[model samples]
Target: MGEEPREHRLATPEGDICWFEWGEPSDRPSLLLLHATGFHARLWDQVVAALPSGFHVVAPDQRGHGRSFRPASLADWTANAAALLPLVDRFAGRPLIGGGHSMGAYVLTRLAAERPGAFRSLLLIDPVIMDPALYAGGDAAPVPDPADHPIARRRDRWADAEEMRARFADRLPYSRWQPQVLADYCEHGLLPAPSGEGYELACPPALEASMYQNALRTDPYAWLGNLDAPVTLVRAPAGPREGGLDFSQSPTWTGLGAQIGAVRDELWSANSHFIPMEDPARVAALLAGIAANQG
Candidate 1:
């Protein structure tokens, strides 16, 4: 956590996924951290900094986000689990500590269910896994094209990270983030524009929109029962309204913890969906406790 991590990239069927490693390999269980949608691996910098020493931490920018290869579309959410299999497998044959936020948490859930022994425990922060009923309807409403989605209109160009930070600093949801966290997000969230202009979002707006459009397409409940590792779910407050485009509202199902084999559910009444960004120290404390449990 003290020093910058060594960056690595792995090629998958979809494309290459970029990952970062901090600390040297040791006998202690390795820690794997995954970021939420539209976020890069570096967003966890603060959390990692607060973690106790001796952990070999690994964080990845899932496909279609950050420095990872981006396909034209990210409509198939399930494909991400498969894409990250190799990265997760690298920590196999030993106990590994896993922590993820939002969609990252959902992906970890899928992988944990598939290979229960690979994970020693899980810290899920406001996962996007909604009520099981939502996934049951085979005839769901058709999703609009990514270009037609509201997120597609997001400002694509930025003069720099500072400018991006200045714009979002006073905005809702983001305004709640720790100043350093927001700085990290802006610093690592942009890439030089392909047009050789200023800069563009690392995760294209259309691709981000595609992810939301097909959010409920994958059902992870079927695999939840197979998990043998203990899970700690940290839920944010339910939306003030049912839900429209409110990013601050929690999307996690209230019953998610009960569906799993061994789990503890927590309600973070004061926080929004972006728990890690809001309180990295709290997240690090929770993760440190999980890591301490390693035998």
Candidate 2:
């Protein structure tokens, strides 16, 4: 493990976007890690721990997650990337390797395209980009009512991190996670309750649900093929094409790898959509390789 990350926050109109930093800048390629929706940046602690020293690393809480601002609604998914533009610009000094998971990957794709030189390369881990067909013709899935969404119904309160860990230790997707990664998730995933008792989810259930409901609204295909940087897509096993948020399987389009000009597709059948959490060491190794090649 490396030195503990130093927490920092950047003020935004909505509120503040919290981020974590590690190591000092040097000639080496800088790394930025983006986490999946509903998950905070600290969830990447295990992966960062395995990374080599002497390279600057950053992990942000995005807008509506972790210690960041809690907006009234998160229906506009593109807003996250927009909010992160400044941070990306500031960290692009050295060659930057952007590593993102799921929604974070989607956000980085947008940033990499919008700000050409902001990223030297991208490592997209199980990004939630759906089949291009869904975005080509018309509107994607209709935004569901926050009140009626399944994720909205998730439990919001926990006695403590230990309780949260104990409750989810045997759960499906969580059970597959590396134990320490799961521990990191629980440890930093909670915030003090407004009532001054116990804790509530750092990402409110309704907001997280709203983000999911509008997931397909922000399509990355517009600039996906136009990206100048090399991209590596790590995908989980293909599951039934049927609908629903099946985290056990990947949500990435099967043909996505072939769609990009400079890309590599790696299908890891043994893991689920949470590849980083399932295997942080391998993810770290892959990032280190990309940094080495780009540096």
Candidate 3:
């Protein structure tokens, strides 16, 4: 892996979108990465490093959290779109590979569906596709996420070690994690609150839950099927919710796997929801192979 610069933030109308551009910027069809809810672009560093040399990779921190905080609206989605067209225009209008994890994948699918011909393909990781109403059994909009459910929001302090680590571990699917990854998640993922005794999560529980509610109203299959470019879905075999929410399935992974077969190609990651953090090498290899065939 070549030494790469740390991620920088892009000034957008909605908020400053945090992103890191690595490899040959002149490379055609840049790789645009969209991370899952509650996480940032830094999570993709290990995976991006393993990508083929000369391939440009741009990973953006979405609205509401990370470096891109506040004043965010649905228009923020447009900013997500802005991150792409200009980048791709610089590279011979090469097919831009739009890759995302969890809610990142959910929003990317919306982008592909919203504009069919603009992007080259879709790469989703353990995407959240079910409507919040399904989980709530017909609750109105702004549904609370299961993990961040009011009860789970009560932390013992501004930085409670036992509480935070336990909750973080509870969110993940696997019983074990790479030591560094686990530590990094715990350190960067939490922030001190006014309480001064323990820490609260950096991402807003209500806002995060609301984003899922907003996405569930839209259908990925309906929206993504309209994409002009082929689609490559990288789904998780299983993991922590990352956003502290359970992914209520519609047809479930079993059915979506069959449905996603309609796409050009689909690879399964069979780990946890935090695929980029957990299995970036595998993802890098899969994406590299697919991009090669498409090229």
Candidate 4:
């Protein structure tokens, strides 16, 4: 199956591990794409197409979301190590270049810390991290669990793509996107259910919100010195100020690039947190260059 998708299952403590892979099998250096918390691997579709066919791309549906089964807590990421680590050897013998968004990026760093030389270069796009207090440390103020936050579980039924698109376009949080792009997001965002149909979020809001807080247990910064892989950090420049709104003040994630200078000697600033989907051509170009170095 040259350039065809291949999937495999691995028995893991979290449940069965499921991963989606594609691109030419003979592609020189391997590139693995990992998505953020509560996201499916398909999120990288646009970015993957612009790459050289000689490059093999493997996108894993990280544990607890997408086709992969979920465990009771976010800590299951560590348990799936068996399934994810061997992938480096089973697919590409050499340290493969890895890129991930948000928690997926965090996972890559954890792997690098635990298993040096597993990846050659690391690309982290708008990762959601900070001192564990945001989720784990003593100073971290406790926010009510999503099991209690209604906005966290705002259930909805979409009659069709237009309805979903229009609804998302109407919302302010995503108001940053172009209308057509927003529509495309809504279209790809929903999954079908039995009969009348229920929409499934590419990310469960509660899970998305919880992982950051829960991530306090793992600190990639403290362990970055151990990893042999070269790292690159990319982020957006501003906060609510750009949106002309006072809401949420400076979105705390805006300055991640400035602070992560040690692990990532360089940072690429973008216009928003949704960088992969927004200006993927640039990301693809960046990854293409990365592939060249490893090749």
Candidate 5:
């Protein structure tokens, strides 16, 4: 039988962070899962359901997304990491395995570095950390204003969940996702509009765009050596070449494994940046393996 998750909300410095928990509160070790920029805690539901019994799992909706309280402004990944510190503290006296996707992966990396003993191991799926060369001279190219970004301009309201699902069923990235995953996204990734007329994206477009704009404000490469636990980085296939930019591929820096203290890197050419939603079974297996090894 699949494990059922319990929903929760915790007070944090940033805001009230919402999360989901699986398994009993025993000494079975804990896994902390963080979702990507525009995703929620429930995004890991599939992975959590597939995990082995007798293990505790927690997944949080990051600030400014999902059911979590939204902050006025998110400075960078560091700020988000700091806000999530309390959740990490919950696993203080036990084995904690950390895993995340894209922006979530970046946050986990930062948190593990800042608190080396907080996690026993890490699984980073297509983390968005950029190459050091891109940060040479401390120069990051300017990002377009959030209001002007394409993501910010996404259609917010829909007649209902079915309408939203139908609209995205044939969309680029959403279209590629597994059917159940897509259903989950449509179901939990939206909320009834404040006006009660329709449903709108749980993660506001403007907030998501702002996050993308500040994606490079903090660099994780500098602290890679501080991590003492084993780490696995799963990267997606290379994106197609555009004029000097490739938006369809993994954003992780090359040679990241070698630079980190103890790391193993794997590439999933068939998956895109959304590895968790694309293949939760594979992700669950990876997390289960890491947890089992710690026994």
Candidate 6:
């Protein structure tokens, strides 16, 4: 049986980051898992439970999300990378296995590039790093106004977690998630509302909107070639047909793996961008395989 995750909080220059740990503390190889925007570290609970023993796992609730501190400026995606550096440095002497999904994946790539020896291998699942051509000539992608975006304008207050779950149970993305996964999301995704009447999303709607609006500002392509560790990219097919729509279609640039000298570029034709949440057990097996190969 997998151990229950131990919660922790680490103070950094950017803010206090909340995290959870699983497995033996004395394990030889350690894994660092980063959650996507608006998600928390506990979201990886099922995936951690399914993994093999002998590897320690660390999953952090990134800034502006979950229980972590929200920074004043929510526009810069690179700030997320900067905030995580101190934690990466803490594991300098040990071999680290790093992996992330979506925005988290992009942050891991940036960290690996900035500190080459931080991780022995990387698993990037449907990262949002786009093609440089799209932002060439100093042209930036247009961001939707926060006031106009539905995510920003979402209802935050719910009578309880159960009420929140019931409200979203039949919704598009939540409907696709497994029962336990959806329950975990509800349990950890909400905080007591300020008015003490109900629960509110840990990551406020406007902050999530800001993350999406400024996502394209940082170009991961600029630093991907600098990483020395082996990389494995597990990508899903473009959205709408599989389950639901995502921010990008085939977000990983064509031939990006080759350009970055990645060891493996596996494509799951049947899965959607939310592969981590959709099939966490598969992700666990992949991580176990990667760790075993390194051993």
What are the models' TM-scores?
Answer: 0.95, 0.96, 0.72, 0.77, 0.93, 0.92
- lDDT score at residue 220, model 6, on the 0-100 scale: 69
Across 75-133, the per-residue lDDT of candidate 5 in tens digits comes to 46688888888888866777788998988988998889888787889998888877776
Off by over 4 Å in 1: 138-143
Off by over 4 Å in 6: 137-145, 239-249
Worst 10 residues of 6 by lDDT: 239-248
lDDT of 2 at 52: 79
Local accuracy of candidate 3 as per-residue lDDT tens digits, 18-137: 666787555467777787766666667677767777787877666666556554333233444455433334444456787877777777776666556667667766676543334442
Quote model 2's TM-score.
0.96
Q: What local lDDT does model 6 show for residue 15?
A: 76
Locate the minimum summed-lDDT window of 10 residues in model 5. Answer: 239-248
What TM-score does prediction 4 earn?
0.77
Model 6 per-residue lDDT tens digits across residues 200-273: 99999888878877766766677887888999998876543321235324566656777788889988776767
Clashing pairs in 2: none
Clashing pairs in model 5, backbone N/Cα/C closer than 3 A:
none
Which 10-residue span in candidate 1 carries the lowest summed lDDT? 239-248
Worst 10 residues of 4 by lDDT: 243-252
lDDT-superior candidate, 5 or 6: 6
Prediction 2 global C-alpha lDDT: 0.87
Higher TM-score: candidate 2 or 5?
2
Give candidate 4 regions above 4 Å deviation. 1-8, 75-83, 131-144, 149-151, 160-162, 170-188, 194-196, 238-270
lDDT of each: 0.86, 0.87, 0.58, 0.62, 0.81, 0.81
User: What's every prediction's RMSD, in angstroms?
Assistant: 1.6, 1.5, 5.3, 4.5, 2.2, 2.5
Q: On a 0 to 1 TM-score scale, where does candidate 3 land against the true structure?
A: 0.72
lDDT digits (tens) for residues 1-295 of candidate 4: 2354577666665476667677656646677888866557766766776676666788877666666766555543454444466555565455478888766777777767777766788887766555333444523445437465443565544666677777767576467554545664566556665464666664566665556445555445566556677778876554434332222222335445455453553334535667676667778898888778775
lDDT of residue 31 for candidate 2: 89
